[model samples]
Target: MSDPGLPPLSRQHDRRLRQMYRSAGWPCQDTVEIELLAAGLLERRLEPSGREYLRVTDLGIARLAQALDRNRAALDAHEALVLRVAEEAQRAGRIAYRGLGLLAKPGERWLQLRPDVYSIRNTSVEDYLEPVVHEIKVRRADLLSDLKKPDKRAGYLALAGECYYVLQQGIAEPEEIPPECGVMIASASRIEVARLAPKRPMKPGFATWMVLAKAAPCRQPLEPEPRL
Candidate 1:
């Protein structure tokens, strides 16, 4: 839990803090800087030449460390879920890929979408490939933010026959997600499908086929040796 007495700081504040820590500490002279100064996270320094610069205080460094740890933990959780989804797809006899950057023209403008897991059925028939996209989210804030972007959903729909949102358990309910997408909740033990995604009759474009051809799919885990 955070201190209720202190003024609330957002990711933007943490980002600025990291930027100042990495750079020469020249002030941006923006509202973010003002808030950081007021919060004692930043201090102004006067050099002998009368030039002014900003410096991160001890408190700021501590805050930055905390932010980094939180980000790392979130990333770990996200990646774990991504691996689970990919493995599940593989078990279903589909070829799965992770972190593939594909171009999608959901509307008039082309957008790049990197789904957490992209999979296609293993079949010789092109129409039966059934490409699917699985987007993983471990944080509620991230899930909510993604829900607001209809364009991103459109891009996923454009690239795959079905799109699904794989969420960390307790992050959200299936009803909160858009009707067009399916929802799956992942716990420590297993993944449960909360909703089934609607399957549309679609085929991957030439660009998508080219990208998949050039990229490698997720490898299956090694099986244990039989007992002697």
Candidate 2:
């Protein structure tokens, strides 16, 4: 299959991903398992909402046919973490939190934006759902004193917007930083549009889906005529 130019599906092992997906299904929370299962990528028997815990089906070999190489590798690394964060957040019962490696669009480009860690909480659901976005810079205590320049802030925000990320978390913690550029969580929940930081200039790459929206037909192609 041709490269979708998209990131890998499962960065960590499959077991970890399943655990996170299952945890997201708790009461009054949103989870991606339903959508993924609907895509036939996951198989499971979910208890009725507010009932028993659901069972997850092991990934079938057939799935490998469609998964990208990066996605497979991601499952080993960041993808697993995405699930871990979701589960941990839900478990902690925190009202606000950060999500990494989620799909977002800035201008035309569809790049992966991973936040170091983001936290959000509000007095009520209404406030939590407001549309807003913000760019954050994490700094070490030593560097924090000197690196408050406007250019740095702008640079970080620009990078965030380019990746369609409204939130940024810079963990200068000696141990928290990863060796690579970064890792983004595959799926996450958005609190509210009003909560995301104000709109900024978008970068060019893959056009934002909204701009590209059109009345295109969704149909399967017909097979070519068989040789006589």
Candidate 3:
């Protein structure tokens, strides 16, 4: 737990603290440093030659650990939801990939976008592949932050015939998301579709095809051995 008496620190502060702990404590001499120093999370040291460097205090280490734990928990939640989505796709006879990177040109500039879950219908016909992109968010802050990036959303739209946002339950209402994208709310029991994503006609470019060919799709679960 953070000390209530101390000034609240942001993730940037935690990041700087970790960087300083890893490196030779070269000071950035910025407001983040001042805030950390004020909160006693960092201390300054002077050598005999008058060179000054920064050091993270014990309290800072504790804060870093806390941040790491929170991040890990969020990551676990995100990955679990991603796995569920991928499995759901497989059950629907689609080939799904997690963490697949691809280039998208939503605007004049091409952007690199890695949709949390990318899938295509399992079919022999290339035109019938129906590529889809699913972006997962377990945290409201992350979802809101992503919403602010129109270019990123555009990039996702460019790559898929259908784009969806799979959010943890209660993070946000379906109305909060843009109309172009679909919304799925995930709970402990099941995932429910809040809104259907509008489908568009799209053909995966040669680059997308190359990447998909090289990457592995999520494996289907194994069946139990038959009893004799």
Candidate 2 lDDT by residue in tens digits, 81-105: 4334434434434322343333343
Clashing pairs counted in every model: 0, 35, 0
Instruction: Give lDDT tens digits, candidate 1, residues 68-162.
Output: 89999999989988999999999999999999999999889999989999999999999999999999999999999999999999999999999
List TM-score per model, in order: 0.92, 0.22, 0.90
Q: How close is each model in CA RMSD to the real structure?
A: 2.1, 23.0, 2.3
Whole-model Cα lDDT of every candidate shown, in order: 0.93, 0.35, 0.93
lDDT of 3 by residue, 63-181 (tens): 89999999999999999999999998998899999999899998899998899999999999988999999999999999999999999999999999999999999999999999999
Q: 2 or 3: which has the higher lDDT?
A: 3
